[model samples]
Target: MAIGWLSILKAVPWTDVVSNAPKVADGAKKLWETVARKKAPTGTSASATSDTSSPAGQEARIAELAGELDRLQQEMLASSQLLKTLAEQNAQLVRRVYWQSRLLLVVGLIAVAGLTLVLLR
Candidate 1:
């Protein structure tokens, strides 16, 4: 089986910064995490105890991890998309406001010029 980036992200314990349980931020990271966990026994050594796990049990655990990776990926993608949209909208608003400011400046100058000419007359 080929381990991908998404697997790795999913496997990282997310509690270091965010929550009590580890949450994978991206699917790509999750994939890589999954791969790393399966290939390296260094991780989860403490969890291996109690003598009930067989090959099938390990497989079940892997399946569960895979599902978690998928869920996290979905969440990350959704959040990223929303942020992108918001950024674009912000940029557009800034542009509009900038133009409006320029227009007001020009109109103000015109009014000032008219008043000065009438005063000279």
Candidate 2:
């Protein structure tokens, strides 16, 4: 089972992923910032304000819709923050994997060199 997983990991193009990780992280950060900086929609819509003669019930419904919109905006900001965090974590993991693969290659080469010298002697 572990060997199968290792093979799959080996097949991935880590260099490409590592190269793109920063861009992904940056994009996520920008998305989060853009969402966070926007002001929430005011509870009073232009239509709601323009028609002062609207019935009480209609005004109440408009207020409720406005509240729902605010809630959705908050949820969007939260989702964007989560996305930014995940992107950062993914980038960190890719960097670690890339370095680990390089280290493994160097170690394998040294081992092969040692074995060849021992055999020659």
Candidate 3:
């Protein structure tokens, strides 16, 4: 199982992922900000305002549609925030993995050098 996982990890291009992580994070941040800053539709449509003489049933329907619009906007904002959070976490994980891979390389080099020195003696 561990070998399978290692093979999958090895298949990934870490350098490319590390390089693009910041871009992904930035895009997510921008998306979240854009969604958050958007103003929700005010529950008053032009028809609703101009047609005060209209029947009460029509007015109620307009109000219901407006409520639904507001709910959708709220849901969109929430989804954007979640996406931003996930992107940031992914970037952080990529950075950590990059550093760990570098450390492992250094440690392997040191071990090889030590073995060479011992064999030479």
Candidate 4:
């Protein structure tokens, strides 16, 4: 009964899902736009704004953004190297299991044969 339920869940109609995804996205976008329009600021003033448009402010913003980008790149590189190391370790583990199982199979066969000989005698 559990197997039947799992099979039913696994048998998803992906083509239908792909076809309907665009419609769902469109509906969500429209809903978000309406909500955003309702919540928009009613007024703007120059005194309330920061000097980001000035040359000095622009240079500072660019330096800050560059620093953030460099940090993110370093983090990405570290994660990628860690992933590679884990994948290599997983492959080694799989090989070790395969060889150990083969050894166990041979030992089991030998034990079974010895038991058969003793029983016959």
**Root-mean-square deviation (CA) per prediction:** 16.7, 9.2, 9.4, 14.9
Our tally of clashes for model 3 stands at 0
Residue-level error in angstroms, candidate 3, position 68:
0.5
Per-residue lDDT over 10-60 for candidate 1, one digit per residue giving the tens place of the 0 to 100 score: 434343335411332453355555545443333455565432277876787
lDDT by residue (1-121, candidate 3, tens digit) is 9997995587456776778678667766766775677666656677667665567856877787787788677767767766776776677767777877787789999999999999999
Question: Runs in model 1 with CA error above 4 Å?
Answer: 1-52
Candidate 2, clashing residue pairs? Answer: none
| Rank by lDDT (best first) | 2, 3, 4, 1
Off by over 4 Å in 3: 4-54
**All candidates: TM-score:** 0.57, 0.58, 0.58, 0.57
* TM-score ranking, high to low: 2, 3, 4, 1
Better of 1 and 2 by lDDT: 2
Return whichever of 1 and 2 wins on TM-score: 2
Q: Model 2, residue 1: what's the lDDT? A: 100
Q: Which candidate gets the maximum lDDT versus the true structure?
A: 2
lDDT of 2: 0.74
Per-residue lDDT tens digits of candidate 2, residues 1-121?
Answer: 9998986588466776778668666766766775677667656677757664568857887787787788667767767766776776677767777877788889999999999999999
Error of 2 at 16 (Å): 22
